[model samples]
Target: MTDYVSTTPGLFPLPDWAKEDLSDLKGHQKGDLIGGDEDGEIAAAYEEARGEVIDRQREAGIDRIAEGQLRWDDMLAHPLAVHDAVETRGIVRYYDNNNFYREPVVSGDLDFSGDVASELEAASDRVEEGLQAVLPGPYSLADLATDEHYGDEAEFLAAIADFLAGEAEAFPDHETLFLLEPSLVESPPEDGEDERASEAIDEVASATDSEVVVQPYWGALEEKVYAHLLDADVDAVGFDFVSDREDNVYNLQEYGAPGSISLGLADGQNTLVEEPETIRERVEWIDDQLPVSAFETVYLTTNTETFYLPYAKFEAKLEALGEAAELAEVKAA
Candidate 1:
């Protein structure tokens, strides 16, 4: 009875009205220097935008609703970017995509300042249940940053893991946390890093009771990396079925998967929307390959963030996912 479908974990594309309103208000665009809204005018606009994202997810029947990351500067660097000890430097291409993010330069000791907790708390006020949080995982955060303090890769990674753990501890109660760790796929770790990566992930997972899903996108991890990922204490691992699905399926068949898995059935980057029945068929195909008892719950989601797509396509994909989840659930029954 794997019957869960969730909003993709990251920034949802800003609506047209939001863009115009934000521009008129001189609001900071994501990846910009996140500014303070002293007069509460800019904050009001962001709140309204966040509310719309939540309402759309609810209408789409998403099981776990995200705050929509309306205030996020970017996924990987945001937490560190806001830290008092860190400085935002030149922009770098994010993974293999055209998108870019400010390189967070670590100048002093990294500390948690309830950066994401405020967003989660505000969203909690809007939705009575199923609210979720999104953050970059330690591995990716450390990998992407420019470390002027630690001076060592492993030490830097460990510090980041601990820093994020501190932030996770302060989060208000929520249903799920999507820890985006695309580095595992973009640049596989060197030998022995896998063990450290698992330990790092466990440190964060131990902080909160909410179910954590370590979602890697753009591609799948290699066998060794995937094996080590399974050793983590996280609740589930998300795979990008939209990109390099064969390798991901091979990893699952060879090493097996956790009882809970998030499958990316919808194409997040493409404009050609998938039909609900098409997505339902993809779920059925996955079930055929893996035993029924292989999973207690399977979460259907996008292979990547919907931020890349137009708002109309993004909403359509979400609606399709919700409908497909129902269809898949009925088939299992």
Candidate 2:
């Protein structure tokens, strides 16, 4: 049986064809793409794009695949930013990167509007292998958005958590649910916030039968934050081994890794192609550093979204990751 799994955190780069189709819809409000005259055309493009992404992952021998999230123009904030109850505000810097996303401002009562669920359902129809669904974690969503309706921060966070839970419950076919939580690393929880954050994550995780992986990329998690994450009601925890390998290793050695851990070995932002041998060597090093049986299942993936790189480079990374996983499997055997 395969003890290790290979997958991505989702959000692949849009193919050229899809980009061309969406060109006309650029600058228009996200809601327009949902039900406007061009909606059918856009949906068809997304379907074609999903098929292409699935083909690439299958060709590269990826064990688990994602829906590619071709329609998520606002990155991880799409589920909330595109909702009818939320209004898109001015552009804001996305975490420490050069990329930006329109800020989501809560204008009315938050509820599940089915935008994300519809995307997942469409993509699921195209994928043949185990499908993984990706979404922004509640803590990260709350941090990225501006709350206008709910006056209290805690109340707003709880509401977002509930909304995410509803979304997760809608997708019962997903094999894995990746909750991307970059805010935990970008803005570490203060004092008592750790418990609150854990509870929020648990709220979302509890609603899904699929395995939940709380993946925080960009950098290593603070010691306190990592401790809190270990207590979260998720199946796996993903760490950014590419951006901050030293810190990640230190944390694993000192505090110990979760029973199920995903290591982001591929760098998603850079255009430089990595050698399969080099990636295999890094995986072996990580395996050697950790205590025996520290992790039950080790998932291999990119540290962040692959949308930052061009399609060619992204494909190369996928091939490299697959080759590395094969090598690691052979070594283990």
TM-score for each candidate, following the candidate numbering: 0.95, 0.94
RMSD of each: 1.7, 2.5
- Can you tell me which runs of candidate 2 are displaced by over 4 Å? 25-38
Per-residue accuracy of model 1 over 14-121 as CA lDDT, tens digit each: 777887777767755543545333247778878888899889989998888988877665556778877888888787887888777778899999877787888888
Worst 10 residues of 1 by lDDT: 30-39
Those runs of model 1 whose alpha carbons end farther than 4 Å from true positions after fitting are 27-39
Question: Judged by lDDT against the true structure, how good is candidate 2?
Answer: 0.82
Which candidate gets the maximum TM-score versus the true structure? 1
68-112, model 2: which lDDT tens digit per residue?
887777888888877888988788888887777888899898887
Error of 1 at 321 (Å): 1.0
